[model samples]
Target: MTKKRKKEKFYVEEGETVADCLNRMAANGYQPVRRMEEPVLKEVKKNGKVDVEVSHQRIMFEGKLKEE
Candidate 1:
């Protein structure tokens, strides 16, 4: 019988590279199942108008525990 897969999300911290995060996950016996990225937007008001600006990008990694 196969066990249910478990998933978790991880973020890339400041001064930390994506590779570092992935390695950390692997060390915990998890493998990356999916990769995601999104933009962090901020609202700016100028000239009686509002605009959305991308302040930074968010990197996310979804991992599933390996069944050993």
Candidate 2:
């Protein structure tokens, strides 16, 4: 029989380091399997035209439960 796998998302908090997030996950018996980052974007319009586009980066981790 094969063990079922589970996935969960973790968001990095302000002032928190990636290592800190990984350590916290380890304490909860979960290990990070993937890393993902997406851009948070917004458009600014002025005088019926797009003036500028702004973007920010969001970091997330996908974790799976550790096998005993």
Candidate 3:
């Protein structure tokens, strides 16, 4: 059988809560080791100028394989 990755990343999908993501990780035989949030950027044009702004935050979790 192929070996599974020791580390994996899980993202909180749209309309999904952080707790839901954690439960998903557990179901996949992984435990969360770290949590992170990255800003989703968007560009806006006003007065013939372009500006960048944060649209939202994307939540992610780094998971480690659970030991048997």
Candidate 4:
């Protein structure tokens, strides 16, 4: 049998709540060990100049495999 990863990263999908993401991790036999958020950057042109802005925050979780 293939070895399963001890740790994995999961992203909160669009339209999904944080609780929903946790539930998903539990369903996959993993427990969340850490939560993180990072800004999503986007570029916009204004008056022939490009400006970078934070579009949104991306939520992610670090999961560890549950011990049986």
Candidate 5:
């Protein structure tokens, strides 16, 4: 038979804020990751006026997420 990988469970007590939860996760040996912001596009011009433009953007928190 193949072996199963172990996973740790996360839980919150009576009351906790986002900061508190993050702190708990750090205490448990979790790493912080960088966040990605939406991209901006340059406006196009037509007949010396404003024209249409398209921009693709996304928000991502890369790497493993911390739990508390």
Candidate 6:
């Protein structure tokens, strides 16, 4: 039997830089391995509101890591 690895998530606050935040997390026992290497379905607009002109887009912001 094989053990399944659980996916981890780290939601950052608005106006937070992903790279900076990830680095901080890494120093504190959370080692960030890789970020979005593939495509994903996501929605983007001027803001939180989705735009009809450009519907959901393929995006990837996944930063894999293990928390201590």
lDDT of each: 0.89, 0.83, 0.97, 0.97, 0.49, 0.50
Q: Write model 3 residue lDDT over 1-68, tens digit each, in one string.
A: 78979999999999999999999999999999999999999999989999999999999999999999
Superposed model 4: Cα runs more than 4 Å off: none
> Could you tell which candidate, 4 or 6, scores higher by TM-score?
4
**Model 4, 38: alpha-carbon shift in Å?**
0.7
In terms of TM-score, how similar is model 3 to the real structure?
Answer: 0.94
TM-scores, all models, native as reference = 0.79, 0.71, 0.94, 0.94, 0.30, 0.35
> Which parts of model 5 are misplaced by more than 4 Å?
1-6, 31-68
Candidate 3: 10-residue stretch with minimal lDDT? 1-10
> Residue 24 of model 4: what lDDT?
96
Alpha-carbon shift of residue 12 in model 1 (angstroms):
1.2
Clashes of each: 0, 0, 0, 0, 0, 0
Off by over 4 Å in 2: 1-5, 43-52
lDDT string for model 2 (13-58, tens) is 7789999999987887789999999887788888999865657777
Candidate 4, residues 1-68, lDDT tens digits: the string is 78779999999999999999999999988999999999999999999999999999999999999999
Identify the runs in model 3 with alpha carbons over 4 angstroms from their true place: none
| Model 6 lDDT per residue over 1-68, tens place | 65424444454445667776676666544555545433334555767787545333332244444643
For model 5, how does the per-residue alpha-carbon lDDT over 4-50 read when each residue is reduced to its tens digit? 22333333333655466556656655544654555556688888998
How many pairs of residues in model 1 come into backbone collision? 0
Q: What TM-score would you give candidate 4 relative to the actual structure?
A: 0.94
Runs of candidate 1 exceeding 4 Å displacement: 1-5
Error of 2 at 39 (Å): 0.6
Candidate 5 clashing pairs?
none
